[model samples]
Target: MKRQVIRSTTLVETLAGVDRQSRFQHRRAFTLMETLAALAILGMVVSSLSASLHLYWKYRSVSRSQITIAQLQRGIIEDLTSDLRMTLQDPVAVRAASMVAAARSESATEKAGSEQFLNVTEQVLELPTDLRNQPVHFIGTSQAMALLHEQRNPRFDQARSSYQSAGLSHIVWWVNSEGSIRLPLFHSGPQLITVAVNASKDRRGLVRKARKDSGGSASSTSDEDEWLVAADVTSLRLRYFDGENWRTEWNSFQQQALPLAVEVCVTIEGGPEQETPVVIWLPQASD
Candidate 1:
């Protein structure tokens, strides 16, 4: 009986040892596999996060560029509208009156000379009539624009005071060869304002002469102030709306009065050829 009891205890110890060894081996295998799987999942998560961050930065840059362009467009439109409101017609009217007076003074030439003097007088009279009959406050083409209007001091600072004291200024907007928008304000100087007009066309789309040339001298030599309105201006188009229809060109010298509405289309770099332009109404100048 003592031998059987010792044998039974040894057998039980052996079986218990085998069971523990098998469980330990199984646990080790499971832990190694779990570690490798966890690492792979972590790598994938990190890769996805990196990709998301890259996309976010790219879109942010594009958004900033778009916003900047929009702000510039709005500024240009506002500046033009504000200046157009306070248009000065008295000067043009006075000039027309003077021309008529000059023509009348030459009336004696019709009897004193041949048809040449008579023809000159007739031509002078016709110009004064056209000026008196038609009020050309604004005139422009696709490339350039001239505004013969009085712009009030839009600022509330010391600059505004100076502008007010200096009186109204003639404003011109034109595009340069380098795709830059330039505005040259002729401070009550009509003669200088003519240099800003790109009314005629040569071999190119429009004749772009020196910005300012006083007798073949470079304009930069003078103290004339020119403001850089905006940059990267690919194109600028204007449309005038009569009560009936919209026209691409506005020749105030030909048209009787200002259009009922005006549309300004500006094309900037990295944008479409023609964007939705700003349209403004001018009921005051319509008549």
Candidate 2:
């Protein structure tokens, strides 16, 4: 009986040892392929995380740019509204004289037998041009516009001219081909104030030029006079309302008048071609 119990105990101990050895061998048998697969999975997870983070920052930057552009658009609308409200009538002897000059330049010099014939022909060719009575003129095209109206200088404390008391300043909003919008204000003292809105030259983003103050130049020769009001503009379009409908083009010289309402549309980079336009209603001549 003692021999039988000792044999059973030794057998049980041998089986347990064998089981431990088998478990160790199984652990050692793990293939390099499995390890590589695990590493690949980890690498993929890390790459995905990095890409997500990159996209998040990129989107955040784009959002900030859009917000800035919206703010700029709002400010422009406000400024334009104020100017249109104070729009002045045509100043005398300006538009009509310009038309006459243009006509005279375009008119062909007729061959005549005598000086008397030439004089008569000149008088007949001279159409009675009405003197311009208002200080406002609007010339618009599909891609650009020139808006000339009157507005009080918001920078009264920094007025260039001391004699400027009333809001009788001639404001000109000119849009160029390179998506630069220039606002030039001329006062009674013939003082000129110019600023550039959304100026982007050669896709360099916002190019800020030093503000120029060269007295009364309608168009500043110096680039330093350009004040950057906004950036990344794509296009600027203006339309005029003639009581009944809207016209894409407005020539004050041809119409010999100002429109009842004006619509201004501005396009920024990465934005739609047509934006919600700022509509300005003008008071009649009687008003």
- Using lDDT as the measure, the top candidate is 2
- For residue 247, give model 2's deviation from the true position in Å: 1.3
Candidate 2 on 1-287: residue-level lDDT in tens? 99999999999999999999998788767766688889999999999999999999999998988898788778766766665665555543244445455555545453443465545456544544542222225545555444453334452233234333343333444443455654433323223244444433544332222233234344443222223444566566678898899998765545656778889787778765668988888776642
Q: Find the candidate with the highest TM-score and give its number.
A: 1
Clashes of 1: 0
- lDDT tens per residue, model 1, 74-163: 777776676555555444434545655555677655576446555754654354422212223566565666565433334312222222
lDDT of 1: 0.55
